[model samples]
Target: MTSDAPHSLPDTLFDTAVVAGVGLIGGSLALGLRQRGLVRRLIGYDASYDVLREAEALGVVDEIKTKPGEWLREAELVVLAAPVRVLPALARELAPFLNPAALVTDVGSVKSGIAAELEALGVRNFVPGHPMAGSERGGVTHARAALLENAVWVLTPTDHTPLTALSRVRTLVEELGAAPVVMPPDAHDSLVATVSHLPYLASLALTHLVARDERLSLLAAGGFRDLTRVASGDPRMSRDMVVANRAALREALLRFRRQLERLEADLEDPEELLAAAQEGKRTRDSLPVVKRSLLPQKHDLVVAMPDRPNQIGRVTQALGAAGVNIKDIEVLAIREEGGALRLGLESVEAVARAAELLTQEGFEVRSRR
Candidate 1:
């Protein structure tokens, strides 16, 4: 849409950029900045030495620092990529290091808590950000440069947050090839509570239920596996995310309980059940699909996936190798022969590339897009 974003990454925007963590989101940001040459000197400071070493070896950062303040003092851009719980304390600790002009942002999902912490510490430069992007896998090793492209990187800037600070963060986000969005801290936490946090809890619950039933394993299929995949993410991190946003999560759960009750009431009414299912399909299909780097907007590139082990992985590997990122996927009406796999790609070009690549690979690929 925008002249195919230069094959070369964006030009450097910061003299010195520092990321507090080298895990998934953090590592990916470092890789992206380094790839685009958007930051002259990228400094990384992670609790784990091994993660820092891996990040350094990957060339995700120009150097690894012994402390956050050491780099914070010199950084033109500082990214707090730590967990939600630690982010508050991080704000307090790093407050002394940041200058009035330094643009400080974070990758914490729960923003209100961190926003409060910054407010308490009179940290006006801190812009709370949460990039709604990640993989099932964690750590720096799996970090990819393409993760941030076209992803909605939400920035929660309260009344106290400086306008210039927000604008600077938006510019940085755009430099990383991401979509920058501004929202109030509490609103963001409340909204994500239902969409992001609740789903993970549901996945965890579903996985727990199925795991307790040994006989279900023999009959488990794509649908079951898809529903439970999020549960496979880091347990401690998952727990922390859910607990850290408890108030909003609690409100969301109560709302979900009402929906559950309504669904239960409609169980006896086939017509109501059918209507509910249809409405759900419409809502799900209409949801916005974030485009990834070198990929097209979310377009359904349909292909028949054979009901066999490694079938899905093969498609993913093929597309990934071709620089086609799958934003989302679905397996519909699965049977022994195969299932219709609807793959969401980023752009018109990505759809064409993916379809052509898959077709050339002997897969029956078709698209309505």
Candidate 2:
């Protein structure tokens, strides 16, 4: 993926595109399509009138509609970006309005259920998809066109899915600056249950457990915040996601409990505990380094700065002045007086330049991989 935006637009473009829901994912996709000139016209549909109006006002879409109508007939592409549980119902309602040439795709987290429902409802061109990218923050207000950049956009096409339809959706995802990974609907659901759904539930449980005592809650530090960050996500959305994939999530939880039991059984054996900890460290460290994709490895640089105003701004400005663009950034640690920022640079040269520039500015900078 490019550092800033899409490297190139798709050769074939949609004449008219409709995005349903117009929430965080929908609005971001709408903005990206419009900004990249991938669609000639874009329309947004949401259950809430205010959301549609806001999306229109923000130019996220060319127009807004409350329900399916003749406008949908003009859409060559329709994106269903609603919650996991309601995707089938939404698609069913909009099915009649969709033209025969239109290809429909959804950004729902769950796949098997919605894929079956859409198929049962006679939506033949449906491609079940889920982008492995999002924020704890919800709504169109938090939407960003770059949200999907470098993200792994999974497309689960069934055997009955037309080859032409799958190709078009894959092209669309690539043009949107994301990697397209094709798998079965059930495989996608099962895999995400462990990596995505389980993590959210774990975050929620940890936060809840710690909240039981005011003293522990107050004493919580950067590590606690890092581990439980997903707990701050929209509860309604989280609930819908986990509940929709409940069976897989339950199995994942059971596996996790078994692992925990194994660890508990070895607590008296210090060497075994050390071995487990070392194994976890090695496994985590050995994880393939990249933004989901195997190619285009990123060079990371960590900078420590005083907790003064404009510290981040100053470093970024210095890098900008040097033509060193930052692909991604994270606040690795935070404190009352200082913090550390991890910056993802595009190349080794960029990281070296950034380190030199920041060091000259009196910041403690270190390169990581």
Candidate 3:
């Protein structure tokens, strides 16, 4: 067994973490924990030993354990990154081996069922979490280090969840550069049903309809490709998500059916349908390409700076120390070696002051707007 204390993670909250199921989420979390210095040691366990070996070789895990019980005994944190269907059984399997104080969390999209199952198994420290981020592709090979960066990670902790355990899980998420949003289990399921499950179902339906049309398949262009792109997601995963959130998904489908019926009714009158389509196009076009918070707000000054370390903090500190409140800020580009940073502020006065201060601090800052 490896010691928990490592020089890389001096302020680490969790000494050791075991990621169950070395798929995309598991592999990505292992990589993030190591890169961000969040944990001293990270180990992985998956049913596929070959994938586990591959993950270890790829540096996603420090070690691979075929026996989860052996690793769970030593882990301070255990993250269940398995499929939604396998989660309840996996929880039951690990329940006996888990330490009394160990923090258990899962990356499953559905929460209510898993929460109830864990509770029934006498797992009190479990905190259900779902990082609202993923790619259409699956597997550990597709796991990227920045998979969770700037993404909203939701934690649905039931009344039985320990406060300390939830806090530790939140810290782990933030360490991976994700923003943590707390919500009730049912609320999370309902919201995901509309925003995520419905979209997946729509994409699948759209893809099936297009595939059935011999002419449409041959002539499908960018628009069709873009709209049906998410249909390429792992079929098994999509099926599980739909089944898990069936109630909320049924509600969303009903609402979608009503909208489709309205459109069909309008199509009976060609002129009215055309006018409605035109109006829809106009409304979509009128919407701002980028949000105001993402872009510069009205009457705000936007400054562009080089992508140097401490450049943003320096500018913000200077403005903040001088009692200047930043209305908005956007990091436009960092793809190049000396890429520029964009800062947006409420007033021209703040911009002028910030620019002067940044220049005095020996940095290149320019006013973009």
| Highest lDDT model number | 2
Q: Please give, for residues 54-144, the per-residue lDDT of candidate 1 as tens digits.
A: 9999888888976655557788888999887788776777788887677889999898988888888887788899998988888888898
The model with the greater TM-score, 1 or 3, is 1
- For each candidate, what TM-score against the reference? 0.75, 0.75, 0.72
What TM-score would you give candidate 2 relative to the actual structure? 0.75
lDDT (tens digit, per residue) of candidate 2 on 83-139: 887887898899888887789999999998888887887778888899888887778
Weakest lDDT window of 10 consecutive positions for candidate 2: 1-10
Alpha-carbon lDDT of model 2: 0.84
Q: How much is the lDDT of residue 369 in candidate 1?
A: 33
The C-alpha stretches of model 2 lying farther than 4 A from their native spots are 1-12, 288-369
Model 2 alpha-carbon miss at residue 47, Å: 1.4
Determine which window of 10 residues in candidate 3 has minimal summed lDDT: 1-10
lDDT of 3 by residue, 309-342 (tens): 7767877887788887776664433233443445
Error of 2 at 268 (Å): 2.3
